[model samples]
Target chain A: MASVLRPAAISRQTCSLVSNRTALLQQASRTRFSETLRTSYLLRESRCLSTTQRKSPSRIPSNDPVAAPFHTSARRQILPPGPQVIEGGVNDPAPVPPTSPTHGSYHWVFERAMSAALIPLTIAPFAAGSLNPVMDALLCAGIIIHSHIGFQSSIIDYVPDKRLPKTRAFFWWALRAATVVVAIGFFEFETNDVGLTEAIKKIWTAKRKEDSYVEPVLRGVA
Target chain B: MISQRFTQISARRVFAQRSISLTSTRFSAPALITACKPLTQSRPAATQTVPEDEAYSILKAQRAVRPVSPHLTIYQTQIPWTLSALNRITGIILSGGFYVFGAAYLVSPLLGWHLESSALAASFAELPTAVKLLLKFGVALPFTYHSWNGMRHLVWDSGRQFSNKMVVRSGQVVIGLTVVSSGALAVYGL
Candidate 1:
């Protein structure tokens, strides 16, 4: 009985060892097959690259086919030599100096005068009694002009006023019309209609009185 | 023979279970493995041209369903409501101040006409002292509130009073200053 059991156990152990060896052999074969495939692929790539390099000697100067076309095109498009005489000739028209300095001085003087005028003008509305129609008209004109200019400046600065031609023209026309209307109203208010009407009535009365006196003198002479 | 067959079946079952366990262990590698596969599979094939209609539909869906971040509308009103209300009130007072200044400047010059043609002094003398005091107080309240609140805004400009406690304290200080200054000015007729 012991002899039979011992042979069976040894046979089982040998079978397990044979299976382990088969698995290791299969893994080694797979690794070798993959390595051979990689080597063949690399060789094919290198051969194709070398054949193309040999065909185009002028284009592939550095033996790098990827950079060949780029370098050739860049050399072909290089700029030609420039003009021999760089400086201007006497025949060329003289360059005019800019008028910015004159403009700057004018702007400075104008700004100073306007700023001085504005300080007194801001308080003028209050100082000029409300009953004085002439002063009121002047104050109204100043306020309207100030408001219109301020509005136009702000619109120009912040809005897309310049981008749309129609809107820009509309704003320009609106500002001009507003100025005309305000000016007409201000002049109408400033005129002395009451005094003028009274003077006309007095002239008519004096002419009637003279006519009555002349007719009486004629009757007395007859 | 039956016992031998049973032992062979048990050995095969044990090996199958071991292989299944090894396959299960692969899932524990990382979350990126599962995440990347779906993304790659969902991409459109490079060779296929998508219909323009379908492209437009997809873009429209993307535009409509895109997430918007939370804003002030999402937060419930609490202490911030008080601050916003105070700001609005101050803005209204400032606008009213412009009218007040305009009327005063325009009418102050007409005071002579108004006093002579109208019974202005007699009307003022008829009013109760308490009403006179109230009118005086009304004039001082707006100026004091505006001045105190302007100072608080200056503090905010300097970037302090950011914390919730500081906000509450500053609000209290604003109220105290407004009441104290306006009341004192009104009483003293300053």
Candidate 2:
């Protein structure tokens, strides 16, 4: 009876130890699997988060946000393509602010005034007006400067004007001639010994006197 | 027996009162409990994917602004240009003015007629007021235009408003200021 009882107890203890060992192994495997699953889930979640953040669209689309706020709303809207839609194909070379309309009108007014001014400019010399010579000189100098500037501007804008070598040559020659004549006239007037009108009258009188001599000589010969 | 029965009745009464109070509390808070559900349901859908070249193609399809050609044909004979031409003409005129002035000055001393002085005086007296006024104004116009336009040029010098709009506006302002000042001087004989 003692031997049979001892064997029974030993078998029972071995069975219990084996069962405990199997249970311990199973729990260790489950913990490792769960840890691996958790790590994979974390990696997937991080990747998804990064993708969303990077793919988000910007609210304002324009490079020049300050100048063109309307472009943002325009970019958001959808419409059918057409000729008008084709306008948006290229990023408009940064839009140049429109030139002021007032400038054109101002130019027009200036042109009119300048036209009207000619009448006075032309009349001034003949008016025999008691103008201060200094003032007249100043005025002439100013006009010369203005013209010089205008001519230069024209040269820049109209390169073709220069390309026509003959036209350019003629213009320069005419300008030089005008300058010389004016200078000579100015000096002559400054030193003239008689009034312009008196000088003319004297010439007339001398011609008459010469005529009178011719007639007398002819009569004497006859 | 009497004590035991009293304890049982008291416990039953307490249980019934607790049930009535719980029911009333739940009814009072029903609206508050249901509020958050609709907010979660109303979230917007996620954005769809797009092709890489879509933006580039859209930009390419847009129209380009053509450059404007300068119009030199019309009013080619206007003030700015006319003034340029007059610069040449004025040289001739000044020579004549000097001759006239000199003749009158020099001949007046020898000739009793003093043709130069009288001519100078008579010329002034003979001119129409309108013409005289116009000449007076003309004298000032060039200076005024130059000064005002010079300021405009200076503005350009500073590298501000170098745009087409500003250039045009400034050109106009220069002209307007010139006209107003010139007109005022002509009327006032300043």
Best by lDDT: 1
Docking class of 2: incorrect
lDDT of each residue in B1-190, candidate 1, tens digit only: 9988756644543333333244434443233233222211111111357796765555444333222323445578765456646654654454344333333333444564332112333344345657655755775676566556655655665588868788778877877888897787566521
Q: Per-residue CA lDDT of candidate 2, range A1-222, in tens?
A: 011123332323333333364564455445544554443333322323343433322332334211111111112113222221233325667556578756566754554444344345434543653234444444444344344334434444443442355655666666555444544443444345343333422322222234456988999999
Clashing pairs in model 1, backbone N/Cα/C closer than 3 A: none
* Overall lDDT per candidate, in order of appearance: 0.45, 0.43
lDDT of 2 by residue, B43-130 (tens): 1112366575765444434321111223344345544454334433443344334434444444444667544433544454456666
Q: Interface RMSD for candidate number 1?
A: 28.6
Give a tens-digit lDDT track for model 1, residues A3-102. Answer: 1123333333333333364564455445544554443333323333343423322332343222111111111212222212222444978767688955
Cα deviation at A222, candidate 2, in Å, is: 75
